[model samples]
Target: MNPTLRPRRLRQSAPMRRLVAETRIHPAQLVLPMFVAEGIDEPKPISSMPGQVQHTLDSAAREVERAIAAGVGGVMLFGVPEHKDAVGSGADAPDGILNRAAAFLAERFGDQTVVQTDLCLDEFTDHGHCGVLTAAGEVDNDLTLERYAAMAVAQAEAGSQLLGLSGMMDGQVAHVRAALDAAGHETTAILAYSAKYASALYGPFREAVDSSLTGDRKTYQQDPANRREGLREAILDLAEGADIVMVKPASLYLDVLADVAAVADVPVWAYQVSGEYAMVEAAAANGWIDRDRLIAESLTSIVRAGADAVLTYWAIEQAEWIGARA
Candidate 1:
């Protein structure tokens, strides 16, 4: 190594390293995903997810206030309906748990921070699939589009600024966008879960939502083995007018995240899924790792991989850490 070109100078001090850092995580770049369930009088702990819980409407609102106070960029809401049906009728019901909670948050906290919703049927459906199924139990792509389009309007009416299309149905983004425009909710944006993978990391999530999944989502969600497909999905979603695009299971898919970020004209985001969080918590519980340090590093790694924003369970805590450090 050339002594004249030594990089050690920048590493000599904390302030010097901070000054030369290429990537930074911000409170506004973190979005916390919340689960609000029906029939729950109190916040019910999601055992698999450790500290997370199925919050009631009022409890969810209070939690959102804390996240907003910490300067988190947004909160993504997932509804857990008490009732499940073949067509997931509760998904678009005006008074359904999800819509009810969404409205509650939007009315009170919309001005304070971004309010987003998971516009999928998994939580409301008895089959536990992301969309409606046919007689043979195969997911009906076109049929699900109709449901999603309706859900879009419903969520928009409930004041969701961003709709997270995580179902992975072909043409979902386009179909939902057309429906929103026709319904006069043109400003409601789509955050396409463009490269959501059929990863094993979703096990804790299913528990959190009380999922009664019929089988698997492999038929819709992308396979984790394909690298190019991730970017292709993002491109397709962008063509369909997605306002923002996301890659799920962030840590393991940095290459894909980078590929999408490199070419995307719109903001690119990543989801640090449940399994990833669980692993760290499990390890930290065993005293194998520093819990807080690993959490911060995990988030920093995702942002460094080209995500403009990150959907993380630790968003609020991360923001507080940032605030304390400042």
Candidate 2:
């Protein structure tokens, strides 16, 4: 073997590997996705996602504090209301659970952590769709944009520093951005779920949010087979004033994530969605894989694929692990 080509030399020691490592996962690059449920007396376990829970309002606040203590960069909040309606009216109501949770977190953290909200209607809609529906039972794109705009202002007024626009609606970013600016929320940011695919990987998430969705969201969300389309969506979001663009179910869409990251002018994020997390957890629980190592490897792979940040359920735990290793 040529001595100069001995790559194993760097891999021979832990310190050498660390020094030569090309990709690293940092606590500051991780964002935790949390759910706060209305009418919950305690943190309720999501059966599909073991070790994950839907927190009560008070518990949600404490979880945010814990995430901050663990050094995670931010928290993305989702609200599960006790009631639902055709138009998802609660989503934009100032007293809505999600809005109240956002207000509480922003007030308590006060710039100590980035408080983000899920600026979508799915959790509040009785039909479990992301937007308003038409008479023909289809998702009304233009009409939904109006609802999204209203929701954006509500979330911003509730003190969310960043809005995770995950509804996959057409013109959603532009609408939300304009509404925010018009409402004097100029500093609020939008983290667009630019390339969210209509994947079966969202099963656990449906449970986490107690989704009433009877059918699929394929009409709105991107198709998993189209890589170029994902990039196009990201580009559109960037042009529409998204501060960051994201690809959901990151492990299954590394190529898409990479493409978005390459063309994105701002930060590009990837979401390790519910199903991805559940698969790893199930395997680890059954002694089929190394839990902590797999978690670290998955996140590192996402970073290596060019994501600037990752939204993951294991964020806090993984952040602590990274800190211990450092």
Candidate 3:
């Protein structure tokens, strides 16, 4: 049998397969998102997120060190305080858990890896809203911006190089950026969650943060049905001085991630949210799928979709796997 084009010939060699692979995952493209509880002496396992924990300050530092050793790009830190308030005073206090975590990470691993912290009040707010409420029981968009600005300054002062504005309030990026620059933190960067949709995927995260949100976030967060609006938000954030723009729930929003990445002049990132991670892990635990293969494939798919970086629960393990292959 004679064939005009022998496609199998190229496929026959391992080196050919490598050369033709269009998408590859790297350790440096992955970021680990961690949670730290203020008063805990030991790490507490989050039942919803298997094998993940709410770390103590000491344990959080150890986790960051491990992530660095694993060659992960960075760590997104969330703090769980023992108290809550209407104004989320914990978010602005230099001695607060989030600030302490930022300071500790900066002091220890500032030169080794990028230190990022959640700059939102939901975890500290009694009502579980992103900001202080008004006389009316609504999550005030303008009011939230003020809180976000202060949170940004606090996080920056505590040594956070990147402020993750996850509050979903209007003009959040611009507000945080102005506050940072006004405080003489010209080097502080904003990673705006530009396309965050109000999704149930955040259930585990809410639990991890001990949030008691009284109502849904539909008031401020974008509805999942609006694809064009997602792009608009990303563009607006870029114009508002975001160094990096991100789409949340990466697996479910790959199209959004791709679109943003295509038009983005700066780096584009995605957050593979809690629900997506739990789904994969649950399937693997039940012997329904190959865990490592699926994890690598999912991360590779995000990369192929044009995400410059991915924030994932599997980041540490994924980084180690990619590094080992290298």
What lDDT is reached at residue 315 by model 2? 92
User: How many backbone overlaps does candidate 3 show?
Assistant: 0
Better of 2 and 3 by TM-score: 2
lDDT of 3: 0.90
C-alpha lDDT of all candidate models, in order: 0.94, 0.93, 0.90
TM-score of 3: 0.97
Angstrom error of the Cα, residue 2, model 3: value is 6.8
lDDT of 3 at 145: 87
Clashes per candidate, residues 3 or more apart or on different chains: 1, 0, 0
Of 1 and 3, the candidate ahead on lDDT is 1
What would the per-residue lDDT of candidate 3 be over residues 55-128, giving only the tens digit for each residue? 99899888898999999999999999999999899998999999999999899999999999998999999999
Per-residue lDDT of 1-326 in model 2, one digit per residue for the tens?
A: 54767768789988998999999888989999999999989999999999899999788888888899999999999999999999999999999999999998899995799999998999999999999999999999999999999999999999999999999998999999999999999999999999999999999999999999989999999889999999999999998999999999899999999999888899999999999999999999899999988998999999999999999999999889888888
Off by over 4 Å in 3: 1-10, 13-15
What digit string (tens of lDDT, one per residue) describes model 1 on residues 16-106? Answer: 9989999888899999999999997999999888899999988998999999999999999999998999999999999998899889999
TM-score winner between 1 and 3, please give it.
1
Error of 2 at 276 (Å): 0.6
Q: Rank the candidates by lDDT, best first.
A: 1, 2, 3
Off by over 4 Å in 2: 1-4
Model 2 TM-score on a 0 to 1 scale: 0.98
